[model samples]
Target: MRKARWLIAVLILCAGVALSQKASGDDAADRAAFEAVCGSCHPVSMASDLRSESEWKETIEVMVKAGAKGTDEQFEAVRRYLRQNLTNVNVNTATAAEIAPVLAVSEATARDIVKRRTEKGNFRTIDELKQIPGVDAVKLEARKDRIVF
Candidate 1:
């Protein structure tokens, strides 16, 4: 019975790892598609300026109208990637999970941001956010445009 239980646990662990890997692979492909489609006309660096979902959708529409070329699958992948990884967040109102991906911060640091906000109230400025311990000031500065308070 113990051996059977151990085998079951190992199978579950393997399945979890496999799923995670597949998700990561999908993300990588999506990112590549975004770069290929967007890079055709403008530098991919320009995309680092985070936008809202509607804004990204509109931008993609404009680009397509203006002659950006990609398959429907590629365009969809690009859209999904942008929405998942590049969209902005309202830090004052956003959950830790939302903040973590947008700001490229760890979950622990994101939780700390929530804790600080809970204790002291909403953040009004970059300087205020920079004051949070364990939060990277430079990274915050780099993504300042993506942050809304």
Candidate 2:
């Protein structure tokens, strides 16, 4: 009986470990994507702020059009991670992901553009952002006037 109980406990412990490990793997995958794709423009100094889930979805849309170059699934994953990390309770110090939603572009697009802008300082006008990575004068011509604070 003693041996059987010990075995049962061991099994439970192993299962718990496995579950945590799986969760950790998912987190790492999100981090990896951000670093690999989002790192080109933004510095990976430390974890950035994250915001709302709904906003994240929108941000993803913007990122896609702006040249994020991710599959729909991957984009969604990034969005989920951002939402998970940056809930509404913490918007003020929200990381880039959180702010992504509030941006004019979708979360993902906002992620790309903002990170680039963060590294580059600030964008005061559309004319200045025209030179931004995915932004061009032609593209700017149509939306330049539309861009606002």
Candidate of highest TM-score: 1
What's every prediction's RMSD, in angstroms? Answer: 6.0, 16.6
TM-scores for all candidates: the values are 0.59, 0.49
Best by lDDT: 1
Query: For residues 1-149, what per-residue lDDT tens digits would candidate 2 score against the true structure?
Result: 99999999999999999999998999888777766655555574433544345555576576567776766666556655555454342222345554443332356655666666657766666566555454446744543333443
lDDT of each: 0.87, 0.57
Q: Per model, how many backbone clashes are there?
A: 0, 15
Tens-digit lDDT string for candidate 1 (1-149): 99999999999999999999998999999999988999998898888867876678898888889999999999989987886668998889888987887787889999999999999999999899888777788988888878899
Q: Model 1: number of clashes?
A: 0
* lDDT accuracy of residue 31 in candidate 2: 70
